[model samples]
Target: MPTSKDLCNKEACDIQSCLKKNGFIPERCRKVIEALERCCEKCSYNSKHCGSMSRLLGRKDEL
Candidate 1:
């Protein structure tokens, strides 16, 4: 059987690229980050990229 396509990869990459363009400032990448979060939520946080949510949100302590 063919494997399923991975989800949220583009959104995750967008966040990384946005951060790089903005000197690693999270505020500048808010929109992209939200996009990724939405994708993760839609997938029930099952995407591999979803594991970085807490870190991306700067709430690693809660994780």
Candidate 2:
């Protein structure tokens, strides 16, 4: 049986591409990150692509 694709992969890749184009200044990628966050929220944070979201959102302290 095949597994279903994880959610938010495109959003995550968009964030990476945005950050690269913006000299790794995450602030410039805020919108893409927010998009991924919204997708992750919809999936209840179960996506593998969401594994780094806490750190990306600067909420690692809560982890």
Candidate 3:
């Protein structure tokens, strides 16, 4: 089974592809962003990289 960090990494990549496929319109990828947020919550058990990414995105919820 995949660890929380692994799942988060996968979700991060998914978000990247979703961004590219949706022309980087954040509004066009709400589901993907939520999914990544869920994954990041799980990732707290293993890593904080997701926190940095969330900060980079300027998402208030993540901070």
Candidate 4:
């Protein structure tokens, strides 16, 4: 099974893409993105280089 962090990253990315394509407010998206960033920072599997990409994915409720 995929780790929770992996799942979070996938979900976040999907949400971010949807928000961007749908033209959602940047501020709102940023809020969730920030949360996603935090989650990525704490993830052992997260890559430093990919943190920005992880943030772009968007945030989800804590696992």
Q: Model 2, residue 17: what's the lDDT? A: 94
Candidate 4 wrongly placed segments (more than 4 Å): 3-7, 21-25, 44-63
TM-score of each: 0.78, 0.78, 0.65, 0.43
Q: Output the better candidate (1/4) by TM-score.
A: 1
**Between which residue pairs do clashes occur in model 4?**
12-57, 13-57
**Clash counts for the predictions, in order:** 0, 0, 0, 2
Record all residue pairs in model 3 with backbone atoms less than 3 Å apart, i.e. clashing: none
1-63 in candidate 4: lDDT tens per residue? 765545456646654675777687555566556555566666643644244554344333331
Better of 2 and 3 by TM-score: 2
The TM-score of predicted model 3 comes to 0.65
**Model 4's lDDT to the true fold?**
0.54
C-alpha lDDT of candidate 1 relative to the true structure: 0.74
- lDDT per residue for candidate 2 within 1-63, as digits (tens), equals 312246787888898899899998777777787888888888888878888665785642232
lDDT of 1 by residue, 1-63 (tens): 311236888888898899899998787778888888788888788777878655885542232
Candidate 3 C-alpha lDDT tens digits along 1-63: 865556577667777888799898676767777777776665553644476467434663442
Candidate 3 ranges beyond 4 A from true positions: 1-7, 45-49, 56-63
Off by over 4 Å in 2: 1-5, 59-63
Displacement of the residue 43 alpha carbon in candidate 1, Å: 0.2
Select the stronger candidate by lDDT from 2 and 4: 2
